[model samples]
Target: MKLLIIEDEKDLSDSIRQYLALEQYTCEVAYEFESALDKICLNEYACIILDITLPNGSGLEILKELKRQGKEDGVLIVSARNSPDDKIVGLNLGADDYLSKPFHLPELGARVAAIIRRKSFSGQNQIVIDHLTLDIRDKTLKNNEEAVPLTRKEYELLLYFVSNKNRVVTKEAIVTHLWGDDVDMADNYDFIYSHIKNLRRKLAEAGCPEYIKAVYGMGYKFSIPS
Candidate 1:
């Protein structure tokens, strides 16, 4: 899953990123409100870890903007205060969950996972389509009864494709989702082509159907006809 950490504390953000990286999540960080807003407006995310206090603006304002835009991205509010009003307001503004500072990293990770599941999978941990079964909690993909071995990037690619099934996903979207802000510095997205190629090869070798389609001059689409 992809997450955006909108936190002012660099140390806390880094720690969160490091911990979540072990869980195979793609993380991007923004320690200020403007940067966070830039990212929020530009890209899509599975979940956003938003701090109530920011240097330039209140994170509550960010939550309000999200609601105003009718964005469906799951949000987990992180605040040091234990104020009930804050929690109530955040929840009222469509924040999925609230977390106090000095929290356990594992618990935070679990909450993020749960929110992603709730929003994307209708509270289910696994997604089944056609002959393929994807266990999000276990990070496993199976073609019928046979398991498909995929690298971390390949697995993430597949999940991204599944999340936007039947839609033409642009190369820029793929690069930003996989590499985060680093795509600005990178020259080309050839690596994405490689990942897609490898994932397709592995899935086909495992006898799965050809579901990923490349849209001419646009990008790629992962679709299955009814």
Candidate 2:
């Protein structure tokens, strides 16, 4: 999933970004309010980690703007403020969860996962498509009674495709989502083909029907024929 971290504290922001990145999440950061607003306007994020206090503007304004635009992205308010009023105001303004400063990074990660689950998966722990079953908490994929082994990238690619099943996903979008901003300067997207090919082969070998389809020169789509 893609995440936006709107934090003015450089150290804390960096820590969160790095930790989340290790968990296979694409994360971007804005140290100030304007940059954060620009990113929100430019990209679609699964969630936004917002700090109530900003140097130039309040994070509450950003939350309001997101709501005004009908953006469904999850918002988690992270602030040093610990007052009950602050929590109430944030939740009322559409924040999914609140995290105080000095919180554990793992706890923040768990909260983000919970919010995404609530938003995208209807609070379910497993996602089922055809004969394939994906365990979200354990990060495992099963076909029938057996486990299917997938590399980290392969697993992430599968989840991405399933989450956006039946929609054509551009190679650029997949690369950016998997590799983050560092993929911008890549020479070609051949690596994407390689990963997709491997994932397809693996799934097929495990007795799963081929669900990934190439859209000519466009992109790829995941679908199970009805």
Candidate 3:
């Protein structure tokens, strides 16, 4: 999954990123309001970890912008403030969950997973599509009860495909979703084509139907055969 961490505390944000990275999530961080606003407005994420306090402005305003844009990215508000009103206001402003600071990292991870699951996977930890089964918690996929080992990027690619099944997704969109701002360093999309090819080969070797389809010059689409 992809996540945006909008926290002012550098140490805390780094810690969160490292911890979540071990769980196989690609993370990007913004330490202030303007940058945070820029990211949220420009890209999509599975969940956003937002702090109510920021260097330039209140994070509540960011929440307002998300609500105004009708963005469906799951949000978990974290603040040192324990006030029920703050929590209430955040929840009312479209945040999916509230976390008081001085919280355990595991708990935060759990909450992030919960928000992603509730929003994207219909609150299920497992995604079953045809003969393929994906275990969200462990980041594993199975074909006909046999384990299908995938590289981290490949697994993420599959999940992204499954999430947007039947819709054509541009290579640019895929790059942004998978690589975040790091795409600026990439010279071309050869790596994306490589990942797609390998993923297709693995699924085919496992006796699964081909789901990912190239849409000529446009992009790629993932769809079950009817």
Candidate 4:
């Protein structure tokens, strides 16, 4: 999933970004309020890790703006302020969860997964599509009760496709979603093609139907035939 981390502590933000990246999440960091606002206004994220105390403004203001825009992005407040009032205000302002400072990265990751599950997958740990089943927690994919091994990139690609089923996702969008800000430095999108091809081949070999379709020069779309 794609995540926006709005934090002022550079070390903390870098740690969170690195840990989440290892967990196969595309994470973007903004250390100040304006940068965070700019990102929130421009991109679509599955979840946001917001800090209440930002360098320029309160993260709560950003939350309010998001709510005003009718955005349903999942938000988790990660702040050093552990007061009851702060927690109440954040929750009332549309934050999905709160984690205090000095928290374990694993716990934070778990909270992110839980919020995503509730918001996008109806709180289910397993996502089933036709004969294919994916265990979100364990990061496993199976077809008709048989395990299908997938590379890390392949698994991320499949998850991204499933989450955005039927949408006309562009090559640029896919690259941004998969690599986040790093896509800007990539030489080309040839790696994306290779990952998609490998994923399709594995799924097809596992007896799954071809669900990923190239949109010519645009990108790809994932959907079951009607």
Q: Rate the local accuracy (lDDT) of all candidates.
A: 0.91, 0.88, 0.94, 0.91
Residue lDDT tens for model 2, 64-86: 88988889899999999999999
10 residues in a row with least lDDT, candidate 4: 217-226
Candidate 4, residues 1-226, lDDT tens digits: the string is: 7899999999999999999988888899999999999999887788999999999799999999999889999999999988999999999999999999889999999999999999888999999888889998888999878889998778888988988888889988888887788887989888898899999999889877889999887789998765
Better of 1 and 2 by TM-score: 1
Candidate 2 lDDT score at position 80: 97
- Model 2 RMSD in Å is 1.7
2 versus 3: better TM-score goes to: 3
lDDT string for model 3 (96-143, tens) is 999999999999999999999999999999998888899999899998
Any runs in candidate 4 off by more than 4 Å, and if so which? none
Q: Tell me the lDDT of model 2 at 200.
A: 96
Per-model TM-score, in order, reads: 0.96, 0.92, 0.97, 0.93
Stretches off by above 4 angstroms in model 1 are none
What are the root-mean-square deviations of the candidates from the true structure over C-alphas?
1.2, 1.7, 1.0, 1.6
lDDT of 2: 0.88
Cα miss at 216, model 4 (Å)?
3.9
Backbone atom clashes (below 3 Å) for every candidate: 0, 0, 0, 0
Q: Which pairs of residues have clashing backbones in candidate 4? A: none
